[model samples]
Target: MHLNRALQVTAAASSLLLVSGCGLFSDSTASTAGFNPPNIKMQSELGPAEGQVNLIAWAGYVEDGSNDPKVDWVTPFEKETGCQVKAKVAASSDEMVKLMKTGAYDAVSASGDASLRLIAGGEVAPVNTDLIPNYEDVFFGLKKQSWNSVNGKMYGVPHGRGANLLMYNTKEVSPAPLSWSAVFDDASKYKGHVTAYDSPIYIADAALYLRETRPGLHIQNPYALDQQQFDAAVDLLKAQRANVGEYWSDYLKEISAFKSGDTVIGTTWQVIANLAESEGAKVKAVLPQEGATGWSDTWMLSAKAKHPNCAYKWMNWIISPKVNAEVAEYFGEAPSNIKSCDETSDPAFCDTFHATDENYWKDVAFWTTPIEQCLDGRTDVKCVPYAKWVQAWTEIKG
Candidate 1:
């Protein structure tokens, strides 16, 4: 999860594994045709729900009412399906991957970062959407995406969607900036007051900015960067490091920074912007002219799930109209279920988040794991992988 609350999925997810000999430097392009996930048979039919189901997820994705009295979705789900929900909150995608590998949990709310890893590692199974009756109500854009499906076979159900927007304190940033240049190329102007996400996945955000300004680079997909493009992005981040006051992974830290006037501008999500504003900080978030990095989370079932029937039932229940709206509104992201738009407590909630606006999301590039084989279809040279991105990120912060 990028935000403290929750966050993303992909089919091209499995495609990255096709690239062989992944290392510091390699010369090969990943081919989707060669990427064959373990031939695990898909569940053909539904069954009786188990007594309970265990879930590994981000903090706010599964609410049993312990956090806030008003935020109890799991309880109702339990009563309705007679399947008790036992959820464990994972602090990071890396942690989620480790947990999922243990096969202790029935389902997971996996983001794009971990979804592919799960698929390639044969940790999660292909979903039988026919068993999930509510799947038909899910938005068209959320279905069969590169993150949630592999070669047209669905692996998970879309939960929600959101973008990492450029957030700036109105008082510190004059004229209300509309482009990402305010934070990338011209970040020095706000030296010692700039911030960015504290994750290797953020490399794609840098790549996204370059996609427009550095046209000669021919960077098509931010996630699929060849050696040259990846280097350029790393270089840009290294330069920006001089102006970074902090690289934040926690929402509270970012909100506090903006409220204290210690940080003026950087990347953020809609929930952070809302929180900062509620605290009386004059902040505004925008999708920069160059588009922005986004997420589309999915509810995936573990291949070795102890409660397969319960997992399927839970997936269907979570995405149902009313429950989907409740979760989307509380978590502060666009609902993947179109019917959820009308079920929101606030009639205009969908409009605010562009919940049903397909065109608004056209420019938002959802997050995905970067592998040795360039995701952009370049074969002559290899692109940096996630491990390399982590090393580069550490170097940039230093």
Candidate 2:
């Protein structure tokens, strides 16, 4: 699912508010200290739960035997847990939010944008880290991010993360694109041949560029925009629209474009880059010097989950080194498990995906779906709000 369209599904349901600025803390301070496990607990010697657990997740997060048999993760999880697993695929954040509201799902593999909404809506609850034994091993940097935690209470478990890289066919563009400016500011060079993710959430990518290139403008979080910052991002995108040959909401579409030599340079994910290469396309997921937007999908339990035991079991199974490696390679994102990359069958997977590599992470600005806090380290009185971003996005795409 395209990131922007995913966000649009939830735009009408909620508006972004201006959150109070608090002093930022490193990951060390954010870690849960002696946290209690969730109200439901499992026996150490017992087998998996003997019940059903429903999950609302993205399209490729779980495999139901439709894709390659090796790609199936849910069946093994169900077999190990002894819990019947029923899965629902959500293409966008908005769809996930709408589906979650029905209270039928026990857990959700939420992106940063939907995680905040689930927490705010009281649809999800804080995870009991003690029960999730593997939680301790999670990277410190990912443990207590702004979107996953509220009042120091964690609402979800970190999974995979990756940047929205500038993917271009090297055969078409020799030097390789280095910055977002090439796509956003000078798109005419590839006019009618460029593609970008279609959704409102993408406003953040534009905001990131403005924050670095035009600090004097004081644009903070793209979602939490004021009038000026909102206009600036919208204006920039409006100019970019003319150069866009297509606004892609589906992964296959973007991949097809790249394979057919339709799209020369545009926004894409790591998985697309890998797939492009397998298909014999000279594509590279470039980390522009200015930085990039990324997504960190979190596994969260529903507040009113029917089968908490099974949910916890699923969490453990999903994060294990073996399963983590499979999902990471299948989905094309860096694994959260530090050791998972080593277990992957593809010897070059780690180098290609940059899993467990700190230097690679530093080069890209991991996607932090805009919240009210304005994550750009702004100490000013205020920053752009979410409502403005929604309105501006509509105008930019219209």
Choose the strongest candidate by lDDT. Answer: 1
Candidate 2 C-alpha lDDT tens digits along 1-398: 22254354343123111100111112534321222334432223333475898999887777767778657888877776678888998988878988888989989999877777777677888887777877765655567776677656677788888888899888887667788887888789899888888877788788788988899876644445665786788888999999998989898888889888889899998888778888887788788888787788889988888887888888877777778888888888877765565466665575577654555665555544454454555545355545556677778878
Residue-level lDDT of model 1, residues 245-307, one tens digit each, is: 999999999999999999999999998898899999999999888899999899999999989
Clashing pairs in 1: 8-111, 8-296, 8-297, 9-147, 10-146, 10-147, 10-148, 11-146, 11-147, 11-149
lDDT of 1 at 353: 91
* Candidate 2 error regions (>4 Å): 1-50, 220-224, 373-387
lDDT of each: 0.84, 0.73
Judged by lDDT against the true structure, how good is candidate 2?
0.73
Location of the lowest summed lDDT over 10 successive residues in candidate 1? 3-12
- CA-RMSD of model 1: 9.1
